[model samples]
Target chain A: MTEHTLAEHTLTATDLRLAYDRREVVHGLSVAVPPGKMTMIVGPNACGKSTLLRGLARLLAPVGGTVELDGRDISTIPGREVATVLGILPQSPAAPEGITVADLVGRGRYPHQGWFRRWTAQDDAAVNEALTATDTIELAARPVAELSGGQRQRVWIAMALAQRTDLLLLDEPTTYLDVAHQVEVLDLLVDLNVTSGTTIVVVLHDLNLACRYADHLIAMRDGAILAEGAPADVVTTDVIERVFGMRSRIIPDPLSGTPMVVPESRHRMENSA
Target chain B: MTAHAVVAGVRRRARLTTLVLAVLAAALLLLALSVGTAVVSLPDVLSTLAGQGSRATDYIVLERRLPRAMTALLVGAAFGLSGAVLQSLLGNPLASPDVIGISAGAGASAVTAIVVFGAAGPPVALAALLGALLTAALMYVLAWRDGVTGYRLVLVGIGLAAILLSVTSYFMTRSQVTSAQDALVWLTGSLNESGLDELVPLAIALTILVPATAISARALDLLAFGDDTASGLGVEVRRTRLALLVCAVALAGTATAAAGPIAFVALLSAPIGRRLARDGGPALLPSALTGAVIVAAADFAAQHAPGLPQVPVGVLTGAIGAPYLLFLLARMNRGGHGG
Candidate 1:
């Protein structure tokens, strides 16, 4: 796989407001995702992590302010042009029934194709490259519906990678996955970022996983950023207590040297105390 | 593989196999054109086609049988293309033009036009189009909440189709016996005869609409991946869907108006086309051709099926289409949430 040199495609929000059905979900939120880095947005459930991710990807329009893509206003950019530079995977990635891994990955070329161009040699090359990168080339012809959760997750990521964009945004990609599958997907993503310098902005629920996988962390509460910095700099017990409303002790991971939080659950420790 | 060696390879063998099948379909179409109710012999049919036959044979070949064959071919093509688009758009096997109430709505409206308004003109096509559009609109409204999901659309279409069919039954019972008999052939679908007057308008509509639909084929393929992903990939989600839905309804409406509601062409053709292509994307032209082949063959079978009272061509399609639907539903049930 030929890794395209990732030019920093900075995504910034200026005083963003987002809502659904006239009810505000995010209010005057502003943040910038530092380009050429893996950034994780972490928060409690319903705290607008997914919504913010959606707004960043331009899948949802901000009710107020502008989302800037690489210094240009995202709303002004043609959707196809925007897609050529930015790709997104929602929480649930739907697969067409009976579609094989290779064919599903090939659909990521939709943004790159014109009406007259059928799949060419280059398209097939990209599909094969994505499959190999995701370690799914052996399962190229297997129907997506028959794959394991971890395998399916890789297939979805491979599809995103097939877009060959500088930036990728994922919304809760590990929601239904087991712990092992979650780690496997996160590891693959890390490899992708390291090898290609692809800017990744992801929403994650597990704080420890977020700290381990992310180079930069954005902690959110009620649609606003609580703190943003390197995992070691931002993922302190005090910050966790404030953002997640849970008392926790912080320690470094033995292997990765990333901040690891050991939550102090009141119910579990009450009898001992 | 060398040039001559590759010619003997599996890929070459597959192509050769399909080429033979395509030739067989062509031959069957020719035989069907010849052996209608009048039983014109193959030699006479061949001579007539070659334009060196008696005036009676020439009249039968060019004027009488040719139009009927053309109607079957065109109507079948429309159904196949429309059904394939609908199935892929709705992302379910059960969602075909006929099963999803588009055809039923057209049939019901055409029946009403004939029975109530005493509409004695070719304007029945207009009524059919109106009925199809209205039915599709109602199905969308009923299915829509946040957005129209595949499961919801099919379920609501089934209910809507049942209601329309009942209304049609009521109208048939109230109409005069002779008009009712004519309505029966129209409802069950027939190609007994069609003048150029009826065939020309349908041909024109198909010509304008089918190509327009092909232009949206890639967009529809993206759509089958589901709404959010399609939109993120730069497909104009609402506009693409509306355009495809309009094309499907128009195709189904036009075919129904031209040939009364023909059976299973829409339902059977798309899956067959998908199988033929052996890929996930909707194969519009191949599906349309399969549809034409199916309807023409079914019409042929209607003439030949012995011991049965002369049934409408649609009866054969229903006999095939209904079981396929059941099989899809059973398979879905068995698979549960795995899909």
Candidate 2:
């Protein structure tokens, strides 16, 4: 479980053009994921942040450019080979009915198991460690359908963890959760990154949480990068307003010392005026 | 519970359910082989199956009943496995071959051969198989956009099924009475006319297809996660889907060629197998065994059920399975998980 370090692979997309049925979602995008760091992509809806992540994760074939993993073209590599080094948790994956948490997590071992090489102790160990890491060992026997939204999300994370990959990508992992559960999910991801040094990439909707948690932050708008750097450096009032089309005030977080955006709503601005 | 223990428990349960279904299928096979006009005893049937019984018993058990029973078992297993693969691949309980029109396509074509072309026996079976394969190809071509999605495939399949059913009705209405009667019996799915000629092709198909399905079972399971997650997990989503679709079409086609689309065996087997196995994964083996048992038992009842005239096995299955489909629809409607 502890054999692989997450810093070995470099994930980069070079001038990628991604489209869904001729309508380009991401146009001429180039980005390098910082190795061994937690990077969060934040942007308004339909801004193509998720599309870029999908391109980087090799879920979508780029129409124009290439995505490289460890200096190799990702499209040229065998899928299972790529899977061993990278894992992604897509948003809103539907659980098969009556699937136990343990069984669902075990499916993450798919890439590792060959036709002749059936399940082994190593696979069990990976699944067990993933379940234990996510604090879902107790729910192993329970059906995923019966789990609450937070528990279900943790189980999904545990599944991605069970893949035992160096790089992990998640698209809005905290969506549909309440504030507390959102924090819990983010903290769990942070713990995973810190403990295993797994390169973590997330597309998040919450600006404050993204600012607080990301080691590197990227802001996207209209299918292009607006700004990317450390949260303290890139998450300014001007960048926030430009990316989100909203007026906002930037302040340092009291607890984390990260830049926090405080949106200035029309009612609040009028009241102050 | 520990993950290891939980996995072990699920596996144990699935294996136990499969074993139980296997035993039931075996017993039903024996009943199907022995109970007929002669009503051979179990001992006689066993000895005849072992090739040591009297000539009379041998002729009854080995020659006539064996082919029929084998057809029921093989066709049921094929439909079961095919249904399990399609349902898991599509991630929808409603996406069985029967519902999605693969069987209807075969039925329509077979009926056309009988009514319009005056075909009989092997030629009709060949026509059915061709129809099934063509319908599957058509469904895939129509469903494909960026790639085939489960919902789109099912929708296209349902539409095709309706069109094929109308074609079959048109043929039936235009045919001579006796030929139409034969086509109707075949459409309702019967094991009465089974012989080595029909069973051999289906047997050959299963020998190739069943193993192929087993090899792709893992990929099929991953596909239930939707295309994005499945591809992200390293599954070649399009290739895997195409492979599984081919295997499923072949299985359904061969079974239809043998016994004319056995209604609902393909549809009911997977869900029942899943429930009996008490596991989340595709219960392929259990579903196959469950299908064998259902068809064999239904064949037995169709022959021996007191006070009822000898009807085709499909009539009984359609009677039993149609209500279940209604029940499923009601459940889906109430739950709003229509897909």
Best by TM-score: 2
Q: What TM-score fits each model?
A: 0.90, 0.96
Worst 10 residues of 1 chain A by lDDT: A1-10
Residue A217 of model 1, lDDT score: 97
| Model 2: CA > 4 A from native | A269-273
Task: State the TM-score for model 2.
Answer: 0.96
RMSD of each: 3.9, 1.9
True contacts kept of 1: 0.48
Q: For every candidate, give the share of true A-B contacts it also has.
A: 0.48, 0.81
True contacts kept of 2: 0.81
The DockQ value obtained for model 2 is 0.71
lDDT of 2 by residue, A1-273 (tens): 564775889999889999988899998989999999999999999999999988998999999999999999999998888888999999988888788999999999888889633889999999999999999999999999999999999999999999999999999999999999999999999898888889999999999999999999999999999999999999878888899999888888999998989888757476445
